[model samples]
Target: MAAVTLICRPAGVLPKLSGTCSPVLLAAGPVTVQHRKIHHAVVPKGKGGRSSSSGVAATVFGGTGFLGRYVVNRLGRMGSQVVIPHRCDQYDLMYLRPMGDLGQIIFTEWDARDKESIKRAISHSNVVINLVGREWETSVAKAIVNAIKDPDANGKTYALVGPNRYLLHDLVEYIYALSHRPYLAYPLPRPLYHLIARFFEMNPFEPWTTRDKVDRFHTTDMKYPDLPGLEDLGIIPSSIEQKAIETLRRHRRYRYLDAEIGETKPAKTVSY
Candidate 1:
């Protein structure tokens, strides 16, 4: 009977086997099992806490703004590593350090107009949170933050209007009421409105109240019925009325302590 001997060895060039092999076994060559690369999803470490690692690395643009600070604070408490990009002075960013653990919060200088700086700021992050509220509605900051965590919000643009939409004139009137001031609305002719807008443009330091802004008083931007909104993200839109008194409390003519706060009439809402 012919007996075939097989020498099973690890794949690479390793030292010869210690034991003496039979002539039949020596005839057989070494056999190897190939290795494969394995990938893994990031898993959070330790109990969910500020010091613990949540395994989320996020880059936050405009992290010093009103809405941005709140977003960064929430992200930090969840143990997410946050990268704040800013063009402000180093001193201006000092207060933000305490928002996260010792090494969890990172700050990098970035300019919105500089593409390379923007890329570098977000290069190491797996998530990017932009709090650019220039054209965004600041009242919807809470909704925006919640939307960021929802996977359904991915690749979707959302309109962040409040629960009730009000005309600009009505909003101003509401603010005037909160401040205990009288409001007078005078309709300007189309030609006069354009002339005033031109005059405002010519002012070196244009006043806060501009004609363009005044135009929005009676005008409403057309809403897109096909677009998604705060309601779509499982967030019940918050009414500005709820937060108005507290926000405008200090702006009252009388000091907050001296003033007896009274109920103000709610602004008229326009149904979309």
Candidate 2:
């Protein structure tokens, strides 16, 4: 049996951190959320996180996404009652079923812009895990969870992040490395990249980010977050260099590349 865990959400002064990290400064109102700190434990695979007894009913917004899955999995293993509210179809949410005990996991159809729908879903639940902060989009889902579980960090916004900045080209290189395929970034002019993106954007089947995204990416600093991060919460963010290779291997398109993780081989069309 897993130990009972407590998660807290607080309302208080936000701490100062490095770099001018900006979000519409939210004035934290009186927060009533209270729970015990969840210490390290296993994330349930098929053996745990199951039960008929009701536990902490936690509502996870954006539960269908990558980070949401991580938080939900942990909560399931811990025997918390997880209520995942999603706008996606049933097929997408079905995978989360095994995370909790038989009746402990729940789902509600809801829309974010509709406050009532949002409120209704979490009304019966006490703890709420907000994973909607995607401005720093490519990172921080799991960090939101660690923040909610921290006590001293009670009520403060936890700005979790990767150790360094990564560009689109850099990520492509890492994916190729996972498959042991040699690859190179053929730098295209800024305007040219935007043109290609726009073409893809026009195709409904191949959506792409707007040019503004490219601008935000270019201006972003590779430095770490100045505020309380993974370290402050006792979590050492995994090494990006190493994790990238492993993570990419799971991708369907690159799964065929049979190189062991971190090992790379020459591309079929390579020059000695």
Off by over 4 Å in 2: 1-55, 133-142, 175-179, 184-186, 195-226, 245-272
lDDT of 1 at 146: 51
Kindly list the per-residue Cα lDDT of model 2 for residues 84-167, writing each as its tens digit.
Answer: 899888998888999887877789999878988977776655466655423433335445444544546544554455555555
What TM-score against the true fold does each predicted structure earn?
A: 0.63, 0.63
Summarize candidate 1's per-residue lDDT along 58-158 as a digit string, tens digits: 67777888767876787788777788998788999888899888888899988789989977775555456666532334435455445445544444555
- lDDT top scorer: 1
